[model samples]
Target: MFRWYQRAQVCYVYLSDVSSSVLEGDSPTSLRRKPAIRKSKWFTRGWTLQELIALARVEFFSKEWNSLGDKQSVLLTLHERTGIAVRALEGSPMTIFTIEERMLWAKGRETTREEDAAYSLLDIFDIYMPLIYSKR
Candidate 1:
């Protein structure tokens, strides 16, 4: 359950299977409110092709990438979301970004070469790919 307190800019979320007293005297100043705008599960906001590609990269290539089948998983997820076919996603090496576009891709416009810094195609496929493509 979620309660919206507009005046205080506070939102109270009640999780299942826990004591309710924790929230008895809470105030917005005491709560950890994430500023990000979270989309509901039923809502898929419009996505530009570039945004999709960029997000795919980040989601697939996060750290812990070596834990499982990453690339294949991302391909499968892309296929499922797009119906473009896994083979095609994997086989086609279409350039997701051009050299000139790198600046735009940089995380927060930081032009750092540090591996942990900005955005790239390799990052996305390294993590969620296997889960997405696992043949069950």
Candidate 2:
């Protein structure tokens, strides 16, 4: 149940049984009619690079993203082609990863969660670059 108040009149909008009429030429429009559909910007904020990668990972692993349907495909493609694991960026505040940090995590050197927390940007790049780029 939703109730809205006007300066002189109170209007009650319900999910069912609504009727109204409008008169032209400086006449007031009755409240009983369907309200005009006001459209505003739906999705304005865009995802950061890291967020995109993370989302790709979810779509890839879950195999739920669809190009024609509600499914997404870009994220999964990036993961499959690159062999890099993407982590969820939901709770994290930082949107973009430094070049070195991206190299390390994406390359797979920081296998354990603990190691990821301990490394600096340079350290991560050094430890993970070889593993990620290895021929095998």
Best by lDDT: 1
Model 2, span 1-136: residue lDDT tens:
0011112132111212211212123543322111210110111112112223323122211112111111132333333333334332321222344655455444432323343333323232323332122243
Tens digits of per-residue lDDT, candidate 1, 26-126, equal 55411311111111121121222223333323222112222112334334444444433343344333345343443333323222244323223333233
- Name the lDDT of candidate 2: 0.26
Q: Give the poorly placed runs of model 2, Cα more than 4 Å off.
A: 1-48, 54-76, 82-84, 88-101, 104-136
User: Which portions of model 1 miss their true places by more than 4 Å?
Assistant: 1-43, 54-56, 60-72, 85-136
Q: What is the lDDT of residue 14 in candidate 1?
A: 23
Output the number of the TM-score-best candidate.
1
Model 1 scores worst on lDDT over the 10 consecutive residues at 34-43
Error of 1 at 61 (Å): 11
Per-prediction TM-score to the true structure, in the order listed: 0.22, 0.19
How far is 109's C-alpha from truth in model 2 (Å)?
A: 21
Q: What is the C-alpha RMSD of each candidate to the true structure, in Å?
A: 18.5, 21.9
